[model samples]
Target: ANQEPIHVQIRQRKGRWIGHTLRKEPSNVTQQALDWNPQGKRKRGCPKQTWKQSILDKLRTTGLTWEAAKKHANDHKKD
Candidate 1:
């Protein structure tokens, strides 16, 4: 329902999700995925970009620290 281009809309949505996840209570179900670290893994060569890393990268690209981004997301969610 937004007039924004697809890519812009996606970034906003993703940022919002990241923000929402961060704001959840520590014991929330969604928090587990964000905090999870696999017990055992040794892939060959270089490692892949992970979901957590991607979120951090996105925050960087948007010129936001995690806390700031979370606040922004929380504030905008009312709309």
Candidate 2:
């Protein structure tokens, strides 16, 4: 951390996990969550945010693009 804000630390942590999950096989639950749609959806007030959205939101705080994050997922070491 070395004096980084708490939010910064959290975002960095989540971003790494998100990137990793996105690279998993489609059969993986983490990967499926990215595009999973519920059947017979109704009674929605505000649209529910998804795990993918939360991951992207965290990556936004780090200024990383979706493509970049995907590529980063393949990196052997974290940035």
Candidate 3:
């Protein structure tokens, strides 16, 4: 079958979803969710990596900050 690997497809979908969310108004619920921080206490130990942290780590590899990513996503020419 002519299709991308499942992981590749998932990555592409995530990128597109993030880009779409970034282009939304700052007050948008979905946009706000991206940077949301939990308020509850956690067990004392090393914390698990969060989705936001994971995304930030990936972006760091590409040398892009959150603001830069937002700008890039907003720039239709780069797509």
Candidate 4:
């Protein structure tokens, strides 16, 4: 004996319903990434620190070691 085909329900723009056989499509990663909203909304502000390298340079000029500068940078990050 032969089996009947499966059907899927779809909605149309004008409040109409229709049924058709289901088909699979190839996945698109780029489109998927573009649609994703993991953060919910975009951040809107200037970054906390500008001229990171220049800040390090100034810290070095003040006799602070690179390790000390890095620590200071991390501390500033907490605020």
Q: What lDDT does the true structure give each of the candidates?
A: 0.75, 0.74, 0.83, 0.36
Q: How accurate is candidate 3 locally (lDDT)?
A: 0.83
**On residues 4-75, what C-alpha lDDT tens digit does candidate 4 reach at each position?**
433212112111110110011125553243234453444578433433344346557678764664444344
Which tens-of-lDDT digit does each residue in 1-79 have in candidate 1?
6488999889888866787787787799887787676565668885765687788897788687867866675576454
lDDT, candidate 2, at 56: 69
lDDT of 2 by residue, 1-79 (tens): 3698989788678766776786788799878877886666657696667767776686687798777877877774754
Top lDDT model: 3
Error of 2 at 41 (Å): 4.6
- For every model shown, the clashing-pair count is 0, 0, 0, 0
TM-score of 3: 0.78
Error (Å) of candidate 2 at residue 73 is 1.1
Question: Backbone clash tally for model 4?
Answer: 0
Estimated TM-score per prediction? Answer: 0.66, 0.59, 0.78, 0.24
What is the overall TM-score of model 1 with all chains considered together?
0.66
Ranking the candidates on lDDT from highest down gives 3, 1, 2, 4
Q: Alpha-carbon error at 49 in model 1, in Å?
A: 2.9
Best by TM-score: 3
lDDT tens digits, residue span 1-79, model 3: 9999999898788878888898899999998888888777778895866677788887898788988888988895552
Task: Single out the weakest 10-residue window by summed lDDT for candidate 2.
Answer: 37-46
Worst 10 residues of 3 by lDDT: 70-79
